[model samples]
Target: MRLFIQLLGRFGVRLDGEEVPSIAWKRDRAAALIKLLAVSPQHRIHREQIMEAFWPDQDVELAGANLRKAIHFARRAMGTQDLITVTREIVAFADEVQLETDMERFEAAATQALRSGDPAECEAAADLYGGILLPDDRFLEWLDAPRERLQQLYAAVLRKGRLWRRLIALDPTDEEAQRALMQAALDAGNRGEAIRQFDQLRERLHAELGVGPSKASIELYERALALSGAEPASPAERIRASLAWALVHLQSGEFDKAAELARETRAQALGGGLAREVGEAGAVLGLTAHMQGRWPELFRSEFTEWVRSRDEFVPSVFDGHLCLAEFCLCDAKGHAAIARSAQELMCVAEDADSVAGRALAGLILGEIARCAGDLEEAETHLNEAERLHAGANALSGRVLVLERLAEIALARGQKWQASRLVQRALGDATQSWLSNHLLLRLQALAVRAATTPEKVEEAILTGDRLLTPGACQPCSMGLRIASAVALTQAGEMEQVDRRLNEAERIAGMWQGGPWAAALWEARGIQRQAQSNKVRALAAFAEAAARYEDLGRPLDQSRCLERMAAVMPAAGA
Candidate 1:
């Protein structure tokens, strides 16, 4: 049977242009299910996947039953059972049913337009755009990637020269068009026109974005200046160039180079009274030092102090990262301050509608709450963070939140839940960046240690893989502390001592900073396991002092409790 599906403007199913009545659909879920099937790449979906996506909170049998009922409703809506194909393992549109959607036509038009390189073709493609795949169903997660892909394709076609001119006419802040025009002008030996284009772009960005030109735009302008044999760049331009390099270094994990460049940029920004630049630079510096495991005191005493000293967060966009990094400097002693700071970041993120900011804030708040023994609050915060990240489709943030939640689960003696969470996290962590993935693997290893004794040896091998030569020092030390704890649990006294010593040596390279205390604490656990009460007492005492000095009362209290448990009954 011939079918025309209108998925662009408003969703509809029509048999040869005659619309299917809305009353035919028994429930909204039926209509939604039809739409889901229509948008699927192959017009087929796994039965289990549909159940999980649509009826996630239901049990397996209930969800499967719901799927069958939804499929029936969909068939009823279309007035033909033959229009849908069903099986025990899969659900799909009928292979024999001749069905066409506006989306397929739109995609075809877009591809043709890009291939033809004709402005008329681009315009035709743009005419097919109806804002979204399903405007009324914006809350649907499955539509997000498809909608975004279409939108990106739409924007990309506009990059054609003639189409670009039209784009600029529609929106002067179309930087892609501006860049293309500038480059085209340069190629045509119209250097003056290129410079003029850059000037217009700078002005438009300033007027609209409430910020300076991006590094790319600035570099373009500088290149034009150099081509014209003009005077050298201003000091500000040089600093911006350096800052751009610093960002590249940071992404590439060259912390030493990044830190050096960031420090220079920060100094320059401070002298120029560029508050936003200063904050960005400091954030980079803090991140660089964190990654390098160097100058830990400076992270707190210098960078963190400066950020707080400001009346308000200068570069509000950087507030989330800076605030979260500041959260790191707060040890157990600073619970109130940590909570207050996280709340501030969370509020800032909420105000900005920044998903990353909200995710980071929620993760930190949840961890702090967990340490403070507020399991309910911890779960709420962590789940919020997980939801936020999942909505944004950000893998790293979700993985981090999952790790925190798993830790909380372990703390509450929910080992089964923790094990499941860790398994999921490990999959994503292995796919993430190197440092994060390594640290995450260590966390997962710790979770592994909880369920069985033999897994401790597995944890040791995992640690070895992570700490093999040329490891990132700070991250390695963090993993070492964790691995030491695992060894202590396994009663591997000698291995624990060696690992603890390596942790100390590495921490010393970073000036025996705040994280060093954890090494000593792990050492105490090892001593206790070895039945060396006197040495264990000393190690615990030192760790407690270290935590107190670092303004972390929670860690201090933890050490004190361990000490209390190991102490003798003096009155006896």
Candidate 2:
């Protein structure tokens, strides 16, 4: 097309490779008329709407006269009456004009790039963004939506291309871009760059808005500092940093990487004779292993020794790590050995007066009690755990403790309280300074506590986030089961079956315990939803038996009640 209009950056018109000087138009409305047409769908707008946009306060007859004069000036300025099409009700560019606009070109490029999902195409499209549409027309109300839409599309292209620096260039105060750039820097081992990016963003945000960076941003900055070893430090400090990085990996569901890093850190700590580092590394490794359904081999010998001589260890060392592993261990199988170890860990925490250790120990004890159908004891232990965890600000521990407390509340038929507890835990889990594993687990708890349709739908949507590959296996399985139960309640039989199938697949790796019992219960719920009373009763019976064997009278009773509900009253 020989006729081209520029709406981005600067506004101008070019015909036959020659610029149309602004002096050609005696009236400014002539140019505005073309711009309005260019931005409208199919380059067309009704004459009445055009008049309202330009001269809203004028009478209809007067606006019509003004519109005709503007059209005359526009055709005169463009040096072609053929380019302006005026109908009885609509004004548009003529069919033979063969006109083009930067806005149209940009939309085409953006559409192609987004549809292709190719980074190179995205980068090309991002480059074409140039600037916002019609900068000179910044004050025009009609330009606002189009300008914002183009800017958003430009940002999306930059994001799809992973052009973080370019995105930051477009908007320096863009925290999302800043965060992305900072992460990219850290991933590339450019710690200084990462820190500098955060500092600049923080300074700019504070100076401009008189507010701090978001919680997510601040937490990420802290993590970068902790994991980057940004400051000169002793070997112990570096070891601690390594442990922090491992913890991040653990939280992100990279269990194998976390385990490997923890092992390396453990070796270093052992070489340096750093007992505290060694213990913490073991804790990291133990937690990763437990999440992955591995037997937590790191705790076998050293942990036993620590349990044997509580004074030989730092009480804080056992606070969340080892205690959490033992809690998970107890969950996997309520074995006497696991319970004894938890007890021993609790004793050590008490003797050392370690609040974190005590809190974690109480969490484990609470889980054991809850599993054994002792809701009263579980609530007492979990409440203590929650208080201590909150005081210490141990987020993961607090989440676990609150989850158990919620479960206990649910067992006692307090769905509202259970939901409140779950929501409280979810609120604190807003950051991933640790693995988002805890967050996924909390979402599953929400599904269980959901009583209303809206709540159930919201919980199910959040629960779907847990079905990702490489999620913590135990949490993933638990979420699927919980989701199945919720889906059954919602009368979504197809979704319930899909969830159950997925849970069954996950259970192939390791099954039994409350997970197995929960799976069976979920199946029972699904069968009952299908009105398959025989299958539902059988499934509930199996679940009740499993719960009975695990010493969970409450769960067994629930399952038994379900079985009774589904059982045939008499011969038909």
- Count clashes in each candidate, considering only residues at least 3 apart in sequence or on different chains: 6, 2
Pairs in steric clash, model 2: 251-435, 319-357
Backbone-clash count (model 1): 6
Q: What does candidate 1's lDDT look like per residue over 310-343, in tens digits?
A: 4233232233133234235423356677677778
List runs of model 1 lying over 4 Å from the truth. Answer: 1-333, 434-448, 511-514, 547-558, 569-572
Give a tens-digit lDDT track for model 2, residues 394-445: 6766877888888888878898998999878877777423334577777877
List the lowest-lDDT window of 10 residues for candidate 1.
Answer: 311-320
Task: Give candidate 2's whole-model lDDT.
Answer: 0.73
